[model samples]
Target: MNKDFNSIVKVWEAAVRKSAGPKKRANRIFSTPMSVAHVDDDVYQVEKILNNGDFYTGQWLNNFPNGHGKYLWTDGCMYVGEWQKGNITGKGRFSWPSGATYEGDFKNGFMDGKGTYIGSNGDTYKGFWVMDMKNGQGTQSYPNGDFYDGDWKKGLQNGHGRYQWKNGNHYIGQFRNGLFNGNGTLMWQNGNRYDGCWEDGFPKGNGTFRWCDGSFYVGVWSKDSKEQSGTYYPSSGSDDDPLEWDPMDLFSVDLIDCYVCGCEKVSIFPSQKNLNMFGLEEDNNNKHLLSKKVTER
Candidate 1:
């Protein structure tokens, strides 16, 4: 068995030597060296040879995958699209050995364009890709039927988006690092709902929280705690007196002591007269008093 294996290896080496000249052999065996444009303008011909991974031939300006054309790694990863010098340029598609595929624009071999990525695990993402990850506006669907549609950054849920769970729970709002943050609305399967600001996946700031039992609170909140400010009226409260009132009337004042001496001598004043009964001098003050007779009854 060892002899047969050695024989096969020898034949393989001989075939490679015959197909590639000195420079080409040096390029494939020692290091990557070739440019597709230098060899031929036919992209299909270049792809055919490169796809085999036996011998790679291209414009050897700077050696390796630096040039305009298709490039395929021996590990079953392949790139088909534009190339500059040796790095991937313009639009392209990369298919990995693991069955993952990315089709979009490329910058130096990194995915950086509007494209779609289908993962080996059955997850799929369609949108803008940056540096080989999901970024910017996009949509992601999981194998379990969960999905998110919105803005993404570095593979995490960020900015405005909508998340739908398999069990019918849904959230529409802002997100940071896959957690609910900023302003948003959550609707549960049991009729409970929350519409307000969120922090680290918890309710915070000013907003309304509604329960399944028809109870609700509309007020300022701090990490889910209600603050001193806010209006929290029971659902069954009467709407006729919507204005809140306090039992203690702060504006009420007590009357001063009477100036009259006798019980029967009740002091009366004209409505139109502006005389200061208490502070007036002589005639004006005594006129009303003198008209009344002192009586015990």
Candidate 2:
């Protein structure tokens, strides 16, 4: 966002220089006609048509545009708003050739305060701007049915925000550089939710996953969310009873006895054959949805 808006500023600066151009560069820029040229100390303001085909019709003070004005560039870019000295300031609307527009408050020629930016691609951003970048709080909506509402920094998602995927998945958490970081909650539409810490976009460290069917796992998840070393308590056994695990395993308990399925230690991999054992095949391959599709299960 910063790089693209700067191009418009460059052209505007050049045009301002041409307003007072010298004869040394007469080929591209010619002298302003006396009728509309800057008249120093004159209280009256009039429209000016420069030789380069640019147009400015507004209030001028001394020799610079200062107050309300309309500036039209030959390249099809246009600005209609307030002006201070020679810079675009106060309230205004800047439109690009592609139909993209920015309407808001400006200070020192940069988009500041609050504004709304509508892109040519149907993306709309309404929020706080600093130096032409989306900063502070804002809401960015896409044409793809996805939406993000929360904190923004330097045109990217930073701090905390809520992102809703077009596919019915949503995450509420802290973010750094657009990826999930710190503590957060990711809830799948299928009724499975994970509350934990995430690094980058993957879940990591200690967390808990609760399935739609009421089965749950509490343990430390690998960075990839592929495997979890914890206790899997069956829905029927809400008490202290847990499915028997390998005695040598670190998560094993000393005297906990298995009673239900006679199921011994369960070693879960991402294969459908292993996941179908407990009717978890509907959410297979997702890995993280259940660990990554067992810990990638």
lDDT of 1 at 153: 87
**Worst lDDT 10-window in candidate 1:** 254-263
* lDDT (Cα atoms) of all candidates against the true structure: 0.53, 0.60
Q: Look at candidate 1 and tell me the lDDT of residue 215.
A: 56
Model 2 C-alpha lDDT per residue in residues 1-297, reported as the tens digit of each score: 234534765666456544532222122222333223334555334454546555566666654567787776555556788887657779998876566788998876677889988777777889998877789999887767677888888777889999876777788989877777889888777787778887776657777777678877777766333455666666654665665322123212210221001111112111111110001111334321110111211
lDDT of 1 by residue, 1-297 (tens): 133644654454445534432121112212122212224442212212322344332333332343444444444444566656545667767665556777777775567879877777767889997776668999887777678899988767889999877666688999988777899988777776778887766666777766566656666655323342455444454454323222111101100110101111101111111111111111354332111121111
* Candidate 1 wrongly placed segments (more than 4 Å): 1-69, 222-297
Q: At residue 14, what lDDT does model 1 achieve?
A: 48
Worst 10 residues of 2 by lDDT: 269-278
